[model samples]
Target: MGAAIDPQVLAARVRNALPAKFASEKRMFGGITFMVNGNMLCCVSKRGLMACVGAAAEPEALARPFASPCFGSGRRMAGFVTVAPPGVADADGLNYWLALARTYVEATPRNASGQKRWRRKSAATEPSRAAA
Candidate 1:
């Protein structure tokens, strides 16, 4: 049998290796997602590391030993790629995936409605306008 995985440790390692421009958020998917400039670049799930690469790179990634589609749908997860288990086991491999994610995130435009779609806070924070 394989060794048990520690999600917290994996998250910490990934967070430390990522560039300062990136930010991390704990996701309900039982993984931590790394975002660059407010855009999601990568995620660390129970399966392994996942990066958000566009469709162009999907073919190459799929042929890689530790690479796979980010989801089971068979359709490439937009802006996301799954890093093989071996890749997540070491710093070098993890760094490689992070670099790819960073590049993709930097090149892509920020989602127009991404913020409004994912924001969890209440609308009370908005300032009230005087009624006419």
Candidate 2:
């Protein structure tokens, strides 16, 4: 069997494939998130890539290979669908999913908590300026 993919590498590949106008951030979902205009486009998890393609397109997205609920079990993610492993093997497929995700996130409401939850606070440092 082929070597298992490292989620971090998968996430980086997806992020690098996105257009320059877009920006990406690593989040706590155990994945890397790509954003366009401050909206999350896609996320790459340990399993595969999750594309955000509105509820209307959910059924269709799910039909694709390796597609599944963003969260393994439990509540379903309304607009998110996972991309098959083979699909994410190259930039063409990666871009395809990223475009779909961008469309969905752009239309959806911003998750204020999402960003806040993932923000990493700087570690406390020893006194840089000694008190007199």
Candidate 3:
């Protein structure tokens, strides 16, 4: 196994690599997720650096060293890849993944609301509703 990753260090690197405009951070997937134009671009979590490289590029991305498909609820999350710490231990490697994610995010069509279309909310995070 590779050296353990420092979450704070990896988060800082992701922040530094992101463009100043059109980028925002949110807590999701048990980590810090970077969004571009209201769409998920990448995230830093225990699993490593997860990038939304788009479904078309998924095959190629997975072929790269230390890259693997991201899974959720026992199913593959198409278009997302988790790169191990060793893959993003350096600036160049991180930049490569970030760039790929950025390109895909930028190409995605924006919703009329100009906000994230959907996200699964945990019970704790979801707002409660009561019959009036």
Candidate 4:
């Protein structure tokens, strides 16, 4: 059997690196995922870090050491890369990936469902000042 994933360790790092609010956690993909602005930022899986970079960043991310395409079923998962311990051996390395995921999550456009992933809750949920 493989090693178990430590969610507390991963979650603590994310809570420290990211803003206190606007981020939520959920259990999915057999791991604990950190979601930013309603979009998936990353996940701590039994394998390692599963980063949700935009499709445009996929090729470059794959070229990096210890990074490989995340797989599911019989297909390669697009826009997601798994980085093992060798890739994020230190805080700096983990921070680098966190930054990458943040940048992509912020820049990505709203998808077909009309859900705005990157918009802050304050802007989307609260009534506008003009309306008030």
113: Cα error in model 1, Å: 7.9
lDDT of 2: 0.69
Of 3 and 4, the candidate ahead on lDDT is: 3
Candidate 3 lDDT by residue in tens digits, 36-112: 76788888976678899999999999999999889878999999998999999999999999989988989997643
After superposing candidate 2, which stretches have Cα over 4 Å from the reference? 1-3, 109-132
Comparing 1 and 2 on TM-score, the stronger one:
1
Evaluate all candidate structures by whole-model CA lDDT and list the values in order: 0.70, 0.69, 0.86, 0.79
Residue lDDT tens for model 1, 1-132 = 123356677788887886565674748345787776677777776677777777777676667667866664556465457775676798877787777777777887775435576666566876566532
Q: Give one digit per residue, the lDDT tens place, for model 2 in 44-74.
A: 6666777778888888777876567565467
Q: Best candidate per TM-score, number?
A: 3
Instruction: Kindly provide the TM-score of model 4 when superposed on the true structure, using C-alpha atoms.
Output: 0.74
Residue range with the least summed lDDT across 10 consecutive positions in model 3: 109-118
The better candidate by TM-score, 2 or 3, is 3
Alpha carbon deviation, residue 12, candidate 4 (Å): 1.5
Residue lDDT tens for model 4, 56-110? 9999888988888888787998999988865665688789888888889977653
Residue 9 C-alpha lDDT in model 2: 87
TM-score for model 3? 0.81
Ranked by lDDT, the better of candidates 2 and 3 is: 3
